[model samples]
Target: MSAVRRLAGFICLLALLAGAVLWITRESARPRESYQEIGLRWLRDEYRLDDATFEKVAALHHAYFATCSQMCRQIKEATRPLLMQTRRQPLSTSTKAGLRQQEQKLCDDCELAAKKHLLQVADLMPEEQRQRFLDDMLSTLETQRLQHDLDMSAHTRR
Candidate 1:
């Protein structure tokens, strides 16, 4: 009877341990892909993105998306006057001054955000990796620029 009780207690302890492990494992959550992922998907679908290019594209996009989000917020704040005054053909001088101030604030915010993000990225990445990342980004930009020029040339020829 004593042996049976000990076996039952051990089995119960094992069951509890197994349950705890399963619970912890099940609790692991998937991180949602950032807005960068959406932008990258759009690029991939619209353009021909190779594997090597896609990796860099995604990383560059992550940085750009972060910057763009900050810029968009600033832009919306800056352009609030144009959005708000739909009824008026011309805004008053005071209103124009307010708009100018908002635009200046937006530009300042964008500059600050870019500075802060670049500093953070440099801190996080190794020197070589950061250089490589920068090169990759510049290459992507160059490719896009070339494509745009070609597109314009084609349109002009037509």
Candidate 2:
């Protein structure tokens, strides 16, 4: 009877451990919020935007996200071949320069798109809030761009 009780206790502990592992795995696999969602939420909270304003902001964001996604896909498709080629062999100096130029152009286009979207959003705000919105959004965007540049430079050095 004592052996039977010990066996039951062990099984319960194993079950609890399995449950914990499963919960952790699910939590880790959950999708994180996209940049657009986070930006919208921050704007709403920071500005105390009303429902109508938020709706307009959200609509603008959704449209911009579609454009941004398309541009990113185009950039990725354009660059994939270059990346694959580089993986196989050393690129000629001219070829590497051309690739870098192409990538910079894509990056510039993305930045322009983001700036346009942010400006449009700022336009939706009241007179007093417009500058604040632009300042905050642009600051956040610039910070992200700088971090991205640093990370890319680090990756290339590796």
Cα lDDT of model 2 by residue, 1-158, tens digit:
69999999999999999999999999999999988799789888888888999999999989988998998897776555455654457667687668767876887888899999989988888778889889987998899878856755554433
Poorest 10 consecutive residues of model 2 by lDDT? 149-158
CA lDDT scores, all candidates in order:
0.62, 0.82
* Candidate 1, RMSD to the unseen true structure: 13.3
Give the best candidate by lDDT. Answer: 2
Model 1 lDDT, residue 45, Cα: 52
What's the CA error at residue 112 for candidate 2, in Å? Answer: 0.8
lDDT of 2 at 6: 96
User: What is the TM-score of each predicted model, taking all chains together?
Assistant: 0.39, 0.68
Model 1 lDDT per residue over 44-92, tens place: 5544555765666567657777777878777777666544554445667
Q: After superposing candidate 2 on the true structure, give the runs of residues whose Cα lies further than 4 Å from its correct spot.
A: 1-35, 78-88, 154-158
Q: Candidate 1 at residue 37, lDDT? A: 73
